[model samples]
Target chain A: MIARRIIVLLLLLGALAEAWPAAQTLVLVVRRDSPVTDLDSVTVRKLFLGVPVLINGTPLRPIRNRSEPHLDEIFLQQIVAMSQPSYDRQILNGVNRQGWLAPSEAASVTRVAAELNANPNAVSFMWERDVAHNPNLRVLRVLWSD
Target chain B: MVRLTHSLWVRMMSVVLIILAALAPLLYLGVSRIVEDGYQERFINSVRAYSRLVADQLEALDAAEFERRAGAVLDGVVLSGQVVFAQIVDGERKIHSSITPALGAASPREDYTFGQSPDQVYYISHQVRRPDHAVVLRLGFDEIPTSERIRATQRHVLLAIGGFVAVSIGLALWLSAVIARPMVLLQESAKRVASGDVHVQLQSHSSIREVAELNLHLERMRQELVGTNEQLTREIAEREASEHKRLTLERRLLHRERIVALGTLAGGVAHEINNIITPILLYAQMALDELPASSDLRADLQRVVESAHRARNLVWRILTFSRQSDTQAPSTVFALRAPVEDALALLRAIVPTNIEVVFRCEAEGVQLTGDPNFVQQVVFNLCTNAHQAMRRDGGRITVTLAAEEDPGEPQLRPGRYGVLEVSDTGEGIDPAALPHIFEPFFTTREVGEGTGLGLSVVHGIVESMGGLITVRSASKLGTTFRVYLPVAVALSNAAGAA
Candidate 1:
């Protein structure tokens, strides 16, 4: 009876966790003059992680969402295939080396995407629908699938 | 014996009261300003903290919750009779809630855009931030009652000032009286002293040291003044007595000199009278014994009577000189040369054969106003002295008659005076003997040869008639004697008073 009660408690905990709202990815967005067309998963990862962030022989940067920490976690896990433990270690190492960037909110990320699409040397990210009106930034599909 | 009050004390007290009254308002203002400054410091600190606490709570809650919480917080704050109002606003100046009952449910957001009221009102606004929105929390307090309280404070201040002024005035009045009382006494004492009461003095032991010292000094002055007054009185009495003694001595000396002169005159007159009487008696007996039975023996008897009458006239002249007994009224005017002529006639026989006499008289020229006897005496004495001086040398005498005008060095002014000068060319008086000639008993001749009262008697007669006599002589030059007699005042007023 105790085992049954433990199983039921675990089930209830999972159900409560699943009941939480899902957080969306924080995409990298840029202007149409951006040189990126076929990007590698590592390069996209490097850009989001603020490493080797040059695009089309010019420097680019990433934008982020500040809605929830879970959103950042989910984007790093699903898109960058980073586990929680490894991500914390990477963040700690980057902080120790003084090489980290803070995340931005959803409205700011879209604003960055619009500003970046008009410039050849800029890079930022947003949801796909958010960049639909901007003709400068082409979708740079990575070879890896989640 | 009088009681007195001092005036300085009253004056000093009044000065002190006036000084205190003048300073009252300034002192009150200074003290009240300090108290209000302290209150303002404490109030500012409490308001700052209160604004911060409310701002934090407002930022943490939603709009509805903020209104409820702010209302409750304002209700919870307890003020000690002071009014307070509180409100909350967003950064856009939108009012969320207000604790002021007078403001009602109205939103005065635009009114508070500048945050502070312009009517010298005191309010505190603190900004608070949340994840979603920023808000402003505000608190205010009314200053009308504070101003009224400040005004109310004046009542106490006025009471304090009044108390100080009253006390100061009272003290001043008391002090002035204390000082002025003795001074008033001193003034009265001074007045008494001026009126010749030197014995008055001020009492001692005044409230002020200076006043006490002054009183002591005044007492000393009084003692000194009394002593001085006594000394002056004694000196004045002694002086008056001494003056009286001197006057008596002068009178006695004058009387003895007159008696001696009278004795000399009496002997001369008695000898002449005896000689004249003897002759008269001898002539009368002869006429009676040798009368022709029917002859005119009447003529012989008449001659004897005439000789007797001449002797009596001479006796009268001597008596007049000796006694100065004539008291008849003075003549209005007479010729200056008449008395000299009469004196020359009296001495005609005594004048030597070699001496020639001359007389000059005008009808009314040299006029004088004096007893004829006194004038004659003055002339006779001088003529006799001149005749005796000339008899020794058989010299010539000149008698001049003129109105004296600029008579000599010490001249009398031009006026009517009869001047008779009997000048002798022989035996002029020495310079040394001239001054003493007018002094009684002073003579150049041997004591038996002359009676020295002649010039002195001349001086007396001339002075009694309000005239002056002067003599100038030298060893070889005959002496000149000028006599000055004043003209009468020449008005009827003088005769009226006389």
Candidate 2:
């Protein structure tokens, strides 16, 4: 009886292991504004939170990604350095002012940038690969290595 | 209702055996394949290492000399216990061998023969090279060691498989015993239940939970079956009693209907006879008035007068229908209060003195279309039945009459239905018996005390006159009998219009 139970348990565990999903990575992309090549954790967080800041003293707003799996706290700690709660609090504090917008994906960042350039007040984030220049939009400088 | 195609034991045994059978081939092939693969892996690794060694060694020699020296080196290695023989061949199929005697005997001589030989031996090959070109070198081994290792592995695998199969068989036997025994018991219990022994009980004690659960189900089924049997028996007995009462009630109702028909027939005959007698009496009286006192016609006149008297005697038969409380004839329209009072008066005489009878005749100007005497009989019967129900002591009977209207059904009309409710503060009638009460001769009273015809007569008269009667009673609440009759024909007709 015990043996039979063990066999059944093994089969059930096997089935469970087979159902688990593969692990994935979350990446951050930035464009150059100064020779300052890669991003620091603090500046990435501040820009994503739409804290009005200067890059060579030009006021800028950063964009965010809206895709799932939504960037969790772990992703923030390792990459963006700001928790989702802190991000939401910052957004709520500046709701009426021009704030950062999360494009649907990295590809839409160019469109958002073009739209933002036309409006002067609007700004958004997109994937680095999707940010080839249309005449209207330019990459703002941020901090990062490779 | 869901039937199993396979019993637990059979299914378990088949699965165990099939698993064992499958494992036998799998274990044999797997162990042998693993052993062979291990040996082959070692052989290939050794061949690679040995080829590198031979190539390094042969680098200083000319190509032809290299083949010859390589063959000698290979022969030296083969002279060791594990190796059989070795050969060196140029790219052409001509072999230079240290074992020239063995090669002379081998058919289809070639420069390099590798893999398993036709004699069922395992061999390994490598390319020996000079700077310009390469030569192939082969080493042959007897393969006895690999075979022996494989046989040993086979033996271990067989032992392991044998051990597992033995354990599985023992387990299967034990599991089948655990599962099959309880199932067999349950099957037996089911058979017994089918054969009309629902009282049998199943005791479940098994390591196998499913079997234990089955035994519990069997036990529950038995309990349910026993309960259903008891309920069925009770229902059957009640039905039989009801049937008996219904038959008696039917007999009484038929008798009452017959009596009423007889009364109507008598009334018709009496009317015809009375009509015939009226003219005869008129003629006789006229003749008596006109006849002279001195004439012999006086004696004849006296005879005529006597005949008229006899005819008058015959008219009394019509008075039978005029009985105050007879259970025959259709009732006529009358003031409802009088008949209700008259009925209570008669019941007062018959009921025990301890029982109090109260009458509230609040309904006035109320009339009904049935015979007053028959209505009185109905009221009297209902009161007496209620009184008898309260035979223990100090019971109160409340009789109430009121003028009310039908709720709807314009054809039945709305106005002036006289409600006569007789309520008794007594032990209530059983609800089981309530529907049967109106059926003739259906009575809770013992035989001879009641013919059970009272409610049937009540129902018949009430229905015949286009009225309604209802009763309500329960174990907790006392009994109430309500009779509703139309007060006047005109009022009913007018209400129909309204």
Stretches > 4 Å off in candidate 1: A1-146, B1-22, B56-68, B78-83, B91-99, B102-121, B241-498
Candidate 1 residue-wise lDDT, A1-146, digit = tens: 99999999999999999997553323454555556654443455565555646554666655554334544543543334344445455556665686665333354544665556555555555555545656656655311111
lDDT by residue (tens digit), candidate 1, B398-449: 6666554444423244444556666767678887776467665567777688
lDDT per residue (tens digit) for residues B230-270 in model 2: 99999999999889888867865675566566446655776
- TM-score against native, each model: 0.35, 0.33
Every prediction: chain A TM-score: 0.54, 0.42
The DockQ values of the predictions, listed in order, are: 0.01, 0.01
| CAPRI tier of model 1 | incorrect
Each candidate: fraction of true contacts kept? 0.00, 0.00
